[model samples]
Every structure is written in structure tokens, then in C-alpha cells.
Target chain A: AQTVTQSQPEMSVQEAETVTLSCTYDTSENNYYLFWYKQPPSRQMILVIRQEAYKQQNATENRFSVNFQKAAKSFSLKISDSQLGDTAMYFCALQKAAGNKLTFGGGTRVLVKP
Target chain B: DAGVTQSPTHLIKTRGQHVTLRCSPISGHKSVSWYQQVLGQGPQFIFQYYEKEERGRGNFPDRFSARQFPNYSSELNVNALLLGDSALYLCASGYRWGEETQYFGPGTRLLVL
Candidate 1:
């Protein structure tokens, strides 16, 4: 079984600034994938970034990036140059390499203030 | 091309009622997954289907069930709904199964009274 944890329930960031959200997961399997999804008021689960457990390099996409630590079992997301549209609920998810289910963290609500 | 689509953007049901939600995956996608997201919480996996076959299931009770069609569309059925069963139902689709990225639809909002 895989379990994900997000320590912060909410976060606030100024527009154009940067904010990082922390996530930690526990799983017995060595091979798996981690993802960050953004859900706006519309309730659409939008993919932000993903990191492979076996990969040493962190994953980055546009203004979104992840700090992945394999030994620590930590995967954190960093949003740079945050915009008003960045305000949303962020979720960290885990999927095993051979499994189809995605276990998710509770989530963190982010508010980007102008 | 169009992304994943789900039917009945919003619904209202009473206790003991049954509701069926529909989802159409992206074109050519063969895998569809279902999730339930209660307000203020992250989405929880319910079921995953590939090639019209059950690939995986979550810890949900037997009250929740799902199936996929040949066209890769899927439906989630809930029996004897309870007020606690109210949630936003999400449908996600992937090009294949396994480690591939899954794309999600807007989701269906269900409210149980």
C-alpha cells in the first residue's frame, strides 16, 4: 500500500513570487511515479508535473517544478512567478510502476494574492 | 482533439437512490479511471479499466461499481447512496495503462440529500 502526506493544509503566496508545497509518501515498492495535480474551482484535476522514483533529476515544467528526494521519500512542488490563476488546491499523488491506482495526499489549498 | 468528457455536470439524489455517471475518454485512449473527491479533500481512486476490462480497484465498498465500453467510455454506478456519498466524481483517461500520465475530465458534481 502507498500513503501520501501533505503537511500544510493551506498556503498563501504573492503574485510573481515563488511558493513551495511539501509532500511525503511511503511505499514498499521501489518503482513508482509521483505527480502534482492542480484543481481549480472548476474541479478539474490538471496535471502540473510528475517525477519518476528511479530518476535522480527533478522534473520541471514551465513555472512548475518538483524537488524529489528518493531516500527521504519526499516530493515537493515549487511554483515560480505565481499568477492569480495559480490559486487552487494542489494534490500530490503516487502510482506504482506496475499498478493502475493512484494514491493521493489530502491536498494543500493555495491562494495567490495580488 | 477533445479531452476527456463526463456527463451530467451536476446531479441531486436522495438517500437510498442510485446514480450512474458517464465518462467518455479522449479519442484512441483505451484506459479510463474513476475517482471521488469530497469537498476539502483530495480525490480517491475508485476503479481503473483498460480495454474494457477491470485493471484495478481501490478500497471503496461494493456499493461503488464501474465498467468500460468498447469505445473506451465508462460509467460509475453507486447503489443505495448515502448523504456522505456526495462528492465530485472525476474521470481520467490515459493512452495506455501503468506509468503513463492520466488526463482528467471536468468532473460530475453529485449532491445527496
Candidate 2:
């Protein structure tokens, strides 16, 4: 079974600064997908960014980007120009090519302080 | 377009009771998945349905069951509920099973006493 781990339980970043949430996973599958999801106080889960294991280049979405190291089994999410709206719980998830379900990390709580 | 929508934003039930949660996927979506998110934890997959057929199921016990309708809507049924069953139930929809990104609904918060 594949499992995702987020070591940091809580993180804080000043407005306009950058924050990085670390994530690691254990998977034997050669091809898989890594995703970062954000859930605000409203409890709405939103996809932040996604990275395909086969892609060497990291995925970037607006101010959100990912540092994916397949060999190290690490996939970290970087939020740049952090705004107050970024305050939420971030989760790292993994899904194999042939799998229908996603394995999610424990999650990291981020607070963007102004 | 509206995103995934779930019914009964909140619910309360007792042990040995049964609860049914409904979800309406985004228009044109054929895949619906159910997840349970306990407090302080990430969402855990419960079931996945595609084209009104059961495609996958998680490690949940038989007490948790779900089915999809021809309209792509879905319902999650839980019987003999335990206090441990109290959590936020989320419904997600995608273009196809394990094909693209899945959009989640606001979720229905279930409280079992």
C-alpha cells in the first residue's frame, strides 16, 4: 500500500513571502501522480498543483509550484507571494496509474500572517 | 458551472442507526467517489463509482456502502453507525475513474452519538 507523509503539522508564513510544505511517500509503482490539495476554513477542498512521476520538470500553477524528487520519494509544495487567503490545511496525495483511490498525507496547517 | 454538490450539509444520528448521504456530480461527469474525513486527518476514500457501476472500494467495513445513479448522482449509506463514524463526508466527481482531476464538494458533516 502507498502512504504519504507530511512531517510538518503546522507552518506559518508572512504575507508576500514564500512557504514550503514537505511531503514524502512510499510507493513501488514506477508511474504515479502526486497532488497537493488545499482546504480552507470553509472546508472546501481545492486542488493546488499536481506532478506526474514521469515528468522531470516541476509543475507550476500561478503562485503554487511543486518540487518533485521521484528518486527521493519527495514531493513538496511551494506557495509564493503568500496571501491571507492561503491560510488553510494542505494535504499531499498520491495515486498510482492503475489505482482508483488516492492515498493522502496527514496534512500541514498553514497560516499566512499579515 | 456548479461544482459537486452534496445534500444535508449537516446530520446527526445515534448508534445502531442508519444514515444516507446524497451527492450530485457536476454536469456531464460520470465518476463519483466518496470519502470520509475525520477531524484532524485527511480524507479517506470510501468508494468509487463510474457509470453507475462500482469500480473500487476502500478498506471500510461492510457497514459503509454506496451506489451511483444513471444521472451520475450518488448516495452513501452507513448502517449501525458508531461514534467513530462521525466525520465530514465528501463527494468528488471526475470525468472518468482515475482519469483526471477530481473536484470535491463542500462535504456533509455527520455526527453520531
Candidate 3:
């Protein structure tokens, strides 16, 4: 079974600053996928970004980027130039090459202060 | 044009009761998945159905069951529910095998008393 861990239960960042959420996983499969999801007060889960295990280059989308260390099974999310709208609960997830189901980390609550 | 939608929005149930929650996927999408999100925790996979067939299931007990219709809509059923079932039950949809970005609904909040 694969398990994802998000050590930081909560984080806070000021507007225009940066915040990083930690994530680590245990997996025996070499090929898989990682993702970051955001759930705001509206309770809607939204996809933030994703990284393929085979892709050495980190994935970035606008102000969001991931530091993926394949060997250490670490995938952390970094939010730059944070805005108040960026406040949400971030989750890290893993999916094996042969599986469509995702195993998610506990969660990290990020608060962006204006 | 609308995104994934889950119905009931909120529910209240007593122990040993049976509850049904509904979900409608985005247009043209043939995959629907269900998840259970407890307070202060991440969502946990419950069931995934594609093309009206069961594709995958999570570690949830048999009390948690779901099905997808030919129209790509879905319903989750829980029988003999327990207080532990109190949580926000979310439904997500994707066009591809589940690898595609999943669009989630506003989840049905279930409170088992």
C-alpha cells in the first residue's frame, strides 16, 4: 500500500510572499503520478498541479511549483506571490501507473494574509 | 458546461439508517468517483466507475457502495450506516481513465447522529 504524508498540518504566508507545503510518500512502483489539490471554504476540490514520476523536470503552473525528489519520494508544493484567494487546504496525492485511484496525504491548511 | 454536481448538498442520518447520495458528471464525461472526507482530513477514495462499470474501489467497508448509470451519473448508497460515516461525501468526474484532472462537486455533507 502507498502512503502519503504531509508533515506540516498548517502554514501561513503573507501576500506577495512564498509558502511551501511538505509531502512524502512510500511506494514500491517506479512509475506513478503525483498531484496537488486545493479545497477552499466552498468545499470544492480543485486540481492545482501534477507531476509524472518519469518526468525529471518539476511541474509548475503559474505561481505554483513542485519540488519532486523521486528517489526520496518527496513532492512538495510551493506557492509564490501568494494571494488571499490562495488560502485553502492543500493535499498531496499519488497514483500508480496501473491505477486510477489516488491515495492522498492528510492535508495542509494554508492561510494567506493580506 | 456545468461542472460535476453532487446532490442533497447536506444530509442527516441516524445509526443503522440507509442513505443515498447522487452525482452528475460533467457533460461528455464517462467516469465518476466517490470519496469520503472526514473533518480535518483529506478525502479518501471510495469508489470509481467508468463507462457504467466498476473500475476501482477503496478500503471502505461494504456499507459504502456506489454505481454509475449509462448517462454517466452516479449514486452512492450506504446501509446500516454508523456514526463513523459522518463526513463530507464528495463526487468527482473525469473524462479519461482517472488520470485526467478530476473535477469535484460541492460534496454532500452527511452527518450520522
Per-residue lDDT of candidate 1, residues B1-113 (tens digit) = 99999999999999999999999999999999999999998889999999999998888999999999888899999999999999999999998878788899999999999
Checking candidate 3 for backbone clashes, the offending pairs are: none
**Model 2 chain A: lowest-lDDT 10 consecutive positions:** A95-104
DockQ of each: 0.84, 0.72, 0.67
After superposition, the stretches of candidate 3 with alpha carbons farther than 4 Å from their true spots are none
lDDT of 2 at A92: 98
**For residue A50, what is the lDDT in candidate 1?**
90
TM-score of 2: 0.98
Highest lDDT model number = 1
Ranked by lDDT, the better of candidates 1 and 2 is: 1
List ranges where model 1 is wrong by over 4 Å.
Answer: none
lDDT by residue (tens digit), candidate 3, A15-93? 9999999999999998899999999988889999999999999999999999999998999999999999999999999
Greater-DockQ candidate between 1 and 3: 1
The residue-by-residue lDDT of candidate 1 on A14-59, one tens digit each, is 9999999999999999899999999998888999999998899999
| Residue B88 lDDT in candidate 3 | 96
- Local lDDT at A16 for model 2: 100
- List model 2 lDDT by residue over B1-113, tens digit each: 99999999999999999999999999999989899999999999999998999989999999999999889899999999999999999998988766377889999999999
